[model samples]
Target: MKKTITFAMLHFGVAFTITYLLTGSWVLGGAVALIEPAVNTVVFYFHEKAWKRAESKQLPLAA
Candidate 1:
């Protein structure tokens, strides 16, 4: 989706900015911009699965 692509770009910018600020190396900044998001994507997938599992285990309250 178009939105998803831009969202990835935004994350890249953030990662690049932070890494650049800390290390002052373009190569490191680029590396983190790609690697960090890749790692986060995997972590986020698992995190979402855990959240869904927790939500499913909750009982509904009586009205």
Candidate 2:
């Protein structure tokens, strides 16, 4: 949960900052900020799944 929130905030800040710098529009910045979290969530879900698969494959088997 905490990881999710942190990742979302990080993505949101980056997206908002970039959008604001390029367009100088608060409305667009706000929209990008809103969209960032949803995008991060989707990305994180796949990332976590991939990590889990990798970890499981590396686990030692019982004798």
TM-score of each: 0.72, 0.74
Model 2 TM-score is 0.74
Q: Report the error of model 1 at residue 37, Å.
A: 1.4
**Which 10-residue window in model 2 sums to the lowest lDDT?**
36-45
Taken over the whole model, the C-alpha lDDT of each candidate is 0.84, 0.86
Candidate 1 shows a clash count of: 0
lDDT of 1 by residue, 1-63 (tens): 454456667888999999999999999999999999867766766777889899999999999
User: Candidate 2, after superposition: displacement of residue 16 in Å?
Assistant: 0.7
Write model 2 residue lDDT over 1-63, tens digit each, in one string.
678778887888888899999999999998988887777788897899899899988968799
Task: lDDT for model 1, please.
Answer: 0.84
Candidate 1 wrong stretches, greater than 4 Å: 1-7, 61-63
